[model samples]
Target chain A: MRLVTTNLTFAEVQPKLREVVDTLFKTVPAGVGSKGFLKISVPQFKQVMEEGVKWAVDNGYGWEDDLKNTEGYGKIEWADASKVSDKAITRGINQLGTLGSGNHYLEVQVAHAANIFDEKYAKACGITTPEQVVIMVHCGSRGFGHQVGTDYLKIFEDAMRRYGISVPDRELSCAPFSSREGQDYYKAMACAANMAFTNRQVIMHRIREAFSKVFQRSAEELEMNLVYDVAHNIAKVEKYKIDGSWKEVVVHRKGSTRAFGPGNHELSSRYQEIGQPVIIGGSMETGSYLLVGTKKAEEETFGSTAHGSGRTMSRAQAKREVRGEQLQKAMESKGIYVKAVSMPGLAEEAGLAYKDIDEVIDTLDRAGISKKVVALKPVGNVKG
Target chain B: MKQKYKFFDDIATADAAFEAYGKDLPELFTNAALATFSVMADLKKVAPKAKKKIVLKNPKAEGLLFDFIQELIYLKDAEYMLFSKFTVKVADGKLTATAFGEHINPEKHQLLTDVKAMTLHMYSVQQTKSGWKAFIILDT
Candidate 1:
């Protein structure tokens, strides 16, 4: 990815695009106890890190050669098994392909549609469907990531007092990349990241299988391509030009995305022409977007963009605001079919609970971190 | 004792409850857990037709609380069941409990947006002068 040259000039991101408006809702997982596919063991779970999409491919989940375009071939750098904690192992054992509840989603989105501004860019990123059934999975390392973060947050806080690293917030705590603790944390984090990539890949495979059964088409005929996969809660050690010099900085982007534009060395050489495809998932009711990283994004937001419409209300609040049954009726009126355990989850996740997604994307566009290529309006969703 | 839930002006947090009754931590936790569920579906219509025991490992105070909510949500999502009475105990800080719930009558359970995941953001638990208070972020 040599993005020293980005051809995205008239390429300002459209932020919140709405062309398909319905078909996107037809895909993905939602809600509590969302299916994790088959029961997997802790040992095979370790294989998840070692193989990434390879495990998925081996299990008839995805393509082994898909690694060519994946970031680090979908495996995080040096994900040693020893780094993951026992509790993380317990949580990961059963949650291999499960889409964790709340905000994390498996959505059916129409990635790109119409001439909506950047047609050339959309075509380059393989957004072929004027109304395409693109399956998008939003998940992470599950309990593994949460436990690693929780376990290490304690370590970092204790070390902070030892090292005297001044920080404004305790949550922003960090140890240098060179230290023993930092290295362990990095390894553990990498394991989680790889697990997440593997998790999504597995879910993608399950989705393809389900779609195959539903549409009566082979996986190849369905063309469930892996457009791009990015981690939201992640940190990367990448070279960013700061103060007119390439600085190897550890970029910590929590609740933000990596919006890398054209000619970046980190990207696969094949994608250099269009820029990195960035996935921004909106609420079930709101829909999602596909944006490309901009050079301006590198300059601003630490090469980041907002992860999703930041929640403005709690599930509790949404529950209070709308009854689950009535909300379902409302969504049905809008032509979106939702299946959930309770109305509270539906109301809480109601598109209105968060900041206006289009506004958030517009903010990112104005900030110049990323620009929209395709807008997907969800028509169907599966709540766990 | 009745404790009211008030939403602190939070961006990611939607519902919150703070209640304290008696000095019993278990009772306090029971109240907090019930408070969160009450916001979703009415427990009045729910009957204790079946009882199930659950165990979660490495359960610190916070992890136990998190797993507790997740377990209930899982039962609801997977089994179409919702619990009313939670007889929970934190022995040596590990979770051991018997919960009472029944299949969610499709006609009764209010279906909200399924909570996708619980977030570490703005999560906290503390013993208040009255009893206990906890804040959690539910990914929607």
Candidate 2:
């Protein structure tokens, strides 16, 4: 999720943002050989899966106030670590704070006051001026989540056969929602979701440390607080009206984000009067946006919106079209500094490979699903 | 004749899928593992500096292939190793293989995107009139 705070203004940190970009690229572990900054044993990894961000905050990585702004207060209630497989635990043990490769990045962006559409709502989320700089960290449960999915696909395949359920494709293999296999997958998924929440929380701590070093001030002095955090690519049981009758159903959001409207009980207290913060990440060469959910979204799209600018080109095509070094120089010419592990990796995520984010956001705005609050232009980026 | 193995651009826009073929089951499994790693890094540049043995058992042939490729992905993420050479043997629903590769040196090796996982979407392993063929999609 992307985060904003009442921190240093753009002018005050422009030069440092450059330095911080390099520092973050080097400081934060990325790619295959990069291990996490903090080491955790299997037991500690289990605790992370169980407690999520609360575990990080309890360990002094972040403050309690940080939780107040996070989704679900940074922990999902249904997470059961016992359901997580040992293979998943082993994959997550050393990857606690590291950002994985391919589209995962830490970016520093500036939100101009003039660009903000809703002054009251934007201010409530801590965006006050054009000079205020924000940080956006995009990542997920990493190998842990992948392993869980792999382990369950095999289980579900067998369960599907046993239940005598057949689908058009093998990929669609699934058991009844009330069955034991279904419940077990849901519990294991919650653990992975919690692991992802903990991942973002720990990365925020690293960002604060990087800022403190560059500005010669503590994180508190900088007022670096989390604006909001959201989860994508997960399933949840949500109550919604169907045929004029309220019913409970599992809302599966893949490549999407939950955009609960004002007064939705799921929102944190600070955002309850407004709406859930919906983060739409753009390519590193392009800029991202901050949005607030609308009642229309709840009525229409099950309180969900697009997660990112949809890809328009394949990675192979992107590599064939542009060189990473040339793309980096172009970004630098536009004042967006980049640090990446490999040039080929960078080429795979070129801006030309994606749709115009401004157009995508405009569709959501014109459609009344989510309203744009502020536009964030990138200043520094650390990519894996 | 079609090549032993090659990648096809997925219509889903971001991922890549591959088809592997062999005259026998073990050869088909070996080719599939090679195709999976090729998606992550250039296989030609990887050196056989180290080797590890992997053993897996599954009641079904497709399950064994899925688990085998997943095991390689796990090693890539957890141990930071990339295997370029594989020798696989399958007998009675059991798979044993010796994989050789070195630790990922970012400076020396120009790594591509990390292959996150093997997907069941369009996953298949079957026998054809010519030989054994398998198709698998990777989540990048």
TM-score to native of every candidate shown: 0.78, 0.97
Candidate 1 regions exceeding 4 Å error are: A1-30, A111-115, A164-177, B4-11, B14-26, B33-140
Total backbone clashes of candidate 2, pairs 3 or more residues apart or in separate chains:
2
Residue lDDT tens for model 2, A147-217: 99988888998899899998988777687888999998998998998889888898889889988888999
Cα lDDT over the full model 2: 0.86
lDDT of the candidates, in the order given: 0.64, 0.86
- Between which residue pairs do clashes occur in model 2? A112-A130, A113-A130
Chain A only: TM-score per candidate:
0.87, 0.98
When candidate 2 is compared with the true two-chain complex, its DockQ is 0.68
Highest-scoring model, TM-score: 2
RMSD of each: 6.6, 1.6
lDDT of 1 by residue, A1-384 (tens): 100011111111112112211222233333433445457777888888666767777877677555655666688767777877776676566567766555666655444345244788776766654655565667777655766676677677667778879676445667867888899898888888888888777676666666555556666775656777787878888787788988888898887878877887778876787677787877888887778888888776667877787778766566678876798888868866666554555666787788888878887777778887777776556554
TM-score for candidate 1, residues paired by index: 0.78
Of the true interface contacts, each candidate retains a share of 0.39, 0.65
